[model samples]
Target chain A: MAESVSEVRAWVNQRRGEGRTIGLVPTMGFLHDGHLSLVKRAKAAGHAVVMSIFVNPLQFGPGEDYDRYPRDIARDRKLAERTGVDLLFTPSVEEMYPRALQVTLRVGDLANRLCGLSRPGHFDGVATVVAKLFHIVEPDEAFFGEKDYQQLRIIQTMVEDLNLPVKVIGCPTVREADGLAMSSRNRYLSPEERRRAAVLSRALFDAARRCREGTTRAAELVQSVTQQLSSAGLEVEYVSAVREEDLGQVDQIDQPCRLLAAVRVGETRLIDNVALEAGKGMGHVSAYVDR
Target chain B: MAESVSEVRAWVNQRRGEGRTIGLVPTMGFLHDGHLSLVKRAKAAGHAVVMSIFVNPLQFGPGEDYDRYPRDIARDRKLAERTGVDLLFTPSVEEMYPRALQVTLRVGDLANRLCGLSRPGHFDGVATVVAKLFHIVEPDEAFFGEKDYQQLRIIQTMVEDLNLPVKVIGCPTVREADGLAMSSRNRYLSPEERRRAAVLSRALFDAARRCREGTTRAAELVQSVTQQLSSAGLEVEYVSAVREEDLGQVDQIDQPCRLLAAVRVGETRLIDNVALEAGKGMGHVSAYVDR
Candidate 1:
């Protein structure tokens, strides 16, 4: 049986009491291959798997696409079961937020940068709801995709700072053959916008090519990508090259760096990033090359 | 055997899987008879009790006694054992907040009244920590005292609005013989200040008495208490009678009302309230009566 939040929690507790491990994969439903990849990873890591299907309202701003966020519990349930997920907690909005919330978690400087600047309270909402879900799910290890790099960082920080016993595992971002990052929001893009959106990844790749060819000034690389994205008829939100681990802006890319950008294709906002290393063409990269 | 947070969580999960009930009583580590009463109640309600002893730093304002908050872990552990608590989670600060928090939960208008007014971010800290604790503990039922009436109300609102699965059980306030409300902070009062502080309760009773005796003017009742507290060598912060539930400031005592006041006795801040019925003398006197 696909268990409710309470039932799954009870079962998880029992298994945990007997010294069993449990894993969690949080998704906004409309589970696709990317979500399944996380579920498969959780199941492989040993333990029962739980998938939470909640389109958290806290993470959405007013006038943002919260109301239009895709949700298909029936389909998500079928996908989760196929992927060996032991439990599915598909709670109603009323079930998640029964009253007004007075307490919130703030992460300080990190949140004020990147996607947070544009989304405003976006990361806070993500952090708060994830914290709540962490409590409800109580998994041994929670899986997230590095595709939403900032979000992944924020969750990692929240879990670590809060001393939550769950280990946060970052999974590689799954992408399409055309190199477009897979997101439920991708559905919002018109057919022309969808084809044009691949320019984001191409721009990131072009930036990575420049970095590999010994181009170090982050500002110059970001400017190049901005022009390319603008030329491609996209409204560029931000184009920056930051340190891969901390997500902090860098003036000169001396080590492995992340080339990230957000742009609006038609009316839909799309974000993407790629890791780059000086003198390495994606393959022969060494970890901590800066030191 | 004693358990860590993970171990305890696992145990709780197992018992829950077996269809047993679990309850949580969240408290800072100075376990007194009052906390024990709550534990006893949880046990009597057929719950396997989990007591969380964390002196949350976020809930304390800068220079508002966060450092001076009392703690005795050894004593608390003994008390938990005596109270038959199945698990006790005493996480370190580093464990509780491993990274900076970015999101905060706010209850809007409710948090702006009473103790909230005096200690600005206090309830936000309380609500956040409690919410974090709620997620970590994942209890079927959580116990809170009506002594901190505003806090109880705010927490109830947060739980209800957030759609958290736990049932919030509001327990009655435990009091001292002289009618002073029992609080962990009460220990901070000097022998002289302790005696003088009882005036807070006395003034509340006085206001309730005047209201019951047909004194419908809330301003007059507030003035009397302010004068009485000042004469008692205490600095009165604010004294107001308002609707018990909504906490809206009202002039006439025509409905359920709360006589609330916050005073600084020497350096220690104390808060107290008494419910007043329109024509009855503090009718159906309950220690922590809601409107």
Candidate 2:
């Protein structure tokens, strides 16, 4: 475990110098099964896995719970080691933003939809910090979970636009047995809220099933998902079908699409998404959605 | 010479596979002695040099001379060959920006002063394009001429703030016999404007001398240099003393400083700077200024 940026660079460089490829799993601490799945995928690919645990304050908005974001260094360390993580980087805020950040990296259009509509400046913060980590780690490939579907697409766009050398590998979204997507913020839910949080995924899975059942209209899918969540006593923030590529809103599901939604269950917010295949819609629904 | 980003990357990666270090010299074509000096420095340091010549539209304001920027691939190729440049990257606008630029990279306080004041969005364009080039080239060291002193500082800050792995080397500003700084835009000056352009450097060199001779007040030094520029029948844009690192306007020359000025002779705008050593400022003036 290294807490300093320079130390981690030295470790990664030493391994690279010896011709070993590196795979990075970037996460905010409080390790969940979803994060470990990425680590497992990295190790499975014969990469010396480096998992970064930085609760990046940049990705949280002013009103968001940056201060209350979950953190447990000791537990996180144990979880990472158990998952066969080769190195763990936990840098302090001072180490990351030593001075006021003057550089603002804003990815247009793609960031203004989905989660970005409610939490502005979130993906810019994500892109900037991710860019910093990419430079610091210089990994051949980096892993991300599909639970942050918008975030994964944004990073992919940023990498393509910037011509970044690293390949982005997005793993499947790990979920609870009841269908709630596993997330670091899942801990913020109350016992009852946790039970209701499953509705977010359930609603999306239901809508995805409707799409597979020959429902072509995006409005119909959105209306069905919104009704399902509202009936479950969740405040629906946004329920829409967007193209998997640029996240553009799709009126008719003619292509591979991502049915995404965000909802407020009590004071906690939960987001989940499921991929809908274009032609063989129902054939792959079971793979993306946990039954 | 490679005209596309992919071709250049392929060539660079092939060299990297053989363990050869690369040094990048990024420029707008009209190959000057200043650029060749960078190539010489790179080769002197045992690096294979890749020089890029693209008149980036992003670095130009809407009304700036991006369209009229000097470009001559034939002459540039001859000069680069004479200087022993290993490769030349001259990507077109379409190649560099395949789509509308969704990502905007803005360097805060550092980019909002000096040259940035007159030409808004210039440094943002510079920062963004440079970032793209950095990713594409993946150079071990990148070179910039100190003639654009504020630009040099801005790029340094960007690299440091972003934790970019490449080292930024600021080469001494190459000057003409009459002390005019070499720039591709210098060709914009009429022969008569060219004669008076030397006054920009002379005024800065003179102020730097006064600072060494115990002229401590920044306002006094600015006044003297401004008067010199105005007396030469040039329309002075600005003449100020600033701390070297941040370009913050300084009140007293108590530390290492820069005396910078911008002026317009007829329709041509020119800029020059002189670095002042804290106690003995004039000690290094001749290296940056021509007699």
Candidate 3:
């Protein structure tokens, strides 16, 4: 386990000396099936896998669950080893941020929509930390779960726009038996809320089913999904279809777009999405399993 | 000459295959003696040097010199080959910015000072371009002339803050026989403005002399330099002494700091600075030469 920036860098440097390619999986700890799936993908790619578990404070709002964010070093270490991770880095907040950050990254208009609308400065925080990790880990490829679809696209866009020296790979979103997208925050849900959380995925699947059947207007899908989540007794933050790249609102699912939603089930806030495309590049997007 | 992104990336990959360390020197074309000096330093460091020449449009303000900024590609080609640069990349605006950039960088408090004050968004442009260049070229070490001291420091801070994977080297500011710092914009100065431009450096040297003789107060140094530039028929934009790292205003030269000044000589605006330290880290900061 690498605990400092220099330690992980030195480890990567040594591996690079041995002619080994590296794949990175960045997460906020309390590793679940979703994160491990990414690790499996990285290992399957014939590259040494590195996983980082730093709950970056910069990405969390003051009112958010930064303080209560899940962490389990022992379990994480065991799981990482079991999953074939070559290196597991868990740098402290102090180690990652030695001082107040004077230089940071801010996303453009793409941030003004979706989750960025309510959780302001959130994506900027995510971009800044991800950029820092790319620098520190110096991995050839990095993996992200598509459950956070907007975040995955944001990271991909940042990499392209900034020409960051890493290939961002999006893994299929992992879901529970009931269709709730697997998340660390699912631990915050009560038994009843956990059952209700399945509605989020149901809504996404409904939209996907509708889009596949030729009803591709984004507004219609969003309105139907919003009704489903609201009727499930969840506080719907947003339900919309946005461009896969910039999250720009689209009138119809002309290209690959994501149907994203955020809802509060009891006190636990959860978000999920599934990719939809009526035109092209729909093969790898999340599919609603007929459970 | 590498004119496209893929071409440059392929060239760099081949170079990397041979285990050759790369040095990058980014410029806005119209190569001058100052740029050659940076190239010379890169060659001396024994790395295969790659210099990029692109006048970034995003960095310019409404009335600023984006369109009129100097360009002579044929002359630049001759100069790069003459100076031992292995690869010269001159990507076009369309190539560097194929799409309207949705993801870009913004420097924090450090950018709100000095040149950043009057020319707002200038360092952000510099930071963004440099970051892109760093990604595009994958250089081992990048050279920057200390003539743009604030810019050099911002790049360094960005590199450190974000843990960017390149060494940012600061070459001593190359100056003329009359003590005026070398700049590409010096081409814009008329014969009359050219002579008066010498006062900018003189004010720097005077402040250095005063600091050496125990007058290390920043306010006192700024006032003296302002008086000298104002009396020399130049419009003073600002004269400041700031910390070497963040460009934070320093009350006294207790640590390594920089005395920065900008003045308009006739229709041309030129800026200059010399480094000072009453305590430590003074060895490499810019020193005023005895003309």
TM-score of chain A of each: 0.93, 0.97, 0.95
lDDT of 3 by residue, B202-267 (tens): 898778777866887889999999999999999999999998977889999988888999989887
* Tens digits of lDDT, candidate 3, A1-291: 989999998999999999999999999999888999999999999888999999999989989999998888899899999999999999998898889887788888888888998899999999999999998998899999888888888899999898887999998888888788889999999898888899999888878877877878999999999999999899999888888867888998888788889999988889998878674433433544322
Two-way lDDT contest, 1 vs 3, winner: 3
Point to the candidate with the largest DockQ: 3
- How would the docking of model 1 be graded? acceptable
Cα lDDT for residue A98, candidate 3: 89
What is candidate 2's CA lDDT for residue B111? 79
Question: How big is the positional error of residue A134 in model 2, measured in Å on the Cα after superposition?
Answer: 0.4
lDDT of 1 by residue, B145-233 (tens): 76777888778777655546688998877778777888889999989999998888888887787778889898999999999999999
Candidate 2 residue-wise lDDT, B263-288, digit = tens: 89998888889876556734767447
At residue A40, candidate 3 shows an lDDT of: 92
* Tens digit of per-residue lDDT, candidate 2, span A73-123: 999999999989999999999999999887768879999888989999899
The segments of candidate 2 whose C-alpha lies over 4 angstroms from its true place after superposition are A278-281, A286-291, B286-291
